[model samples]
Target: MITDTHTHLYSAEFDEDRAAMIQRAKDAGVSRFFIPAIDSTYTNRMLTLEKENPNDVFLMMGLHPTSVKENYLEELAHVKEWIDKKSFCAIGEIGIDLYWDSTFIKQQQEAFRTQIKWAKEKKIPIVIHCRDAFNEVFEVLESEKENTLRGIFHCFTGTLAQAKQAISYNMKLGIGGVATFKNGKIDKFLNEIDLTHIVLETDAPYLAPKPFRGKRNESAYITNVIDKLVDIYQVSYQEIAAITTQNSKDVFGI
Candidate 1:
């Protein structure tokens, strides 16, 4: 079974066809969908998604770095409150994001560290969303390193050295549509990294794969990712699916 280790299934983009979209993923052999949080605004939508797909969906609670702003503390409180009150698979999609604005870099760093501490305390994993801030993200992970500080580096598109560094910190490389891009350098050396350290994701409604690239993404297109991995690792599609799904379970614990 394919496990989309990271997917924003509740994004407004799926509002009109969420159920059908999920069905398509199942039809495509995707059995698990791990949902990440953007901020408190999307919390209810996320829970509603889980309610509708209880057997196949898992939830994560955290304040997204991009969502870090003037009232970031309040947002972080929302994340911590939900985390304390319910069972979540992980504490993410959290981490440094300098891709857009760096005005709140300090706040982003604080939020990343705080959430990492919470995830460590709960013994659950973290799903990072590092964007143009690998060094900053790595700095936090490095300082917060511990036996329980483990997770998936969501949407990983880093150098081989960065990939190995993330693995050293107990993170699985979350491979997605980027791997299918014509210039997605990761695919060139992905075979060098063992499949055991890879996990598949679509980041749906965002980074769709080739043939469907530049279009709206969905879990149904996860097979495109699997197909890419099959070529990258020179393994069968079934082998790539099983191995990456297993890698996801290793991080999410479900």
Candidate 2:
């Protein structure tokens, strides 16, 4: 009954063996798959995947931070268009990214704030994608703090204080392959945080767990993440699975 609260199975990297990878994940007890949006370009592919695996795959809509550029207004409009027409699990993979380019920092912040409004209006959870911009993310989140602005901090790799700050906004921390890396420091900080605020993810076709590190990742690899959690928290696999799955359901209502 393992749940991969976040993944990107539709990426071109999985083109050849997508079905096989998903089947392997199911066989490994990775039953739930939450698909995130990269941008408008992948919308059709995302819908196609959801249509094929409606029972296991859930969809989210938003403009990813890196995708925020000069034409960000149009991207935000597209996100709103989808939310207004149909139901999505969340407003996700959205936030600030200064790692790649700082040229659009201001635009990224503006776009993130606009999407936050849509998430609040639709009463859906948010999935934040933070990289080299934790302070920027916290700034937006702090200003928009409210009951409806609840969600997960995808691929969290911040300090214990940052984790607590995110929790204060009624958000969950999305733990993934990074936690299993040999030099990964996420586990050190995560051990200090409450598991009640943790959710499992693969961020698939990327961030593969150790032993499988640097390899193409998929939901099936989440088993490795679960194994690490058992050791970190000194709890049974089933116990960690059950609690994390429940935590995911509490946030996504899936």
The candidate maximizing lDDT is 1
Global CA lDDT computed for model 1: 0.93
TM-score of each: 0.99, 0.98
Candidate 1 lDDT at 62 equals: 94
TM-score of structure candidate 2: 0.98
Clash pairs, model 2 backbone:
none
- What would the per-residue lDDT of candidate 1 be over residues 1-254, giving only the tens digit for each residue? 99998899999898899899999999999999999999999999999999988899999999999999999999999998898999999999999999899999999999999999999889999999999999999999889998777899999999999999999999999999999999999998899999999999999989999989999999999999988888888889999988888888888889
Task: Give the worst 10-residue stretch by lDDT in candidate 1.
Answer: 244-253
lDDT digits (tens) for residues 26-70 of candidate 2: 999988999999899999999999998989999999999999988
- Count clashing residue pairs in model 2: 0
Q: Give residue 221's error in model 1 in angstroms.
A: 0.5
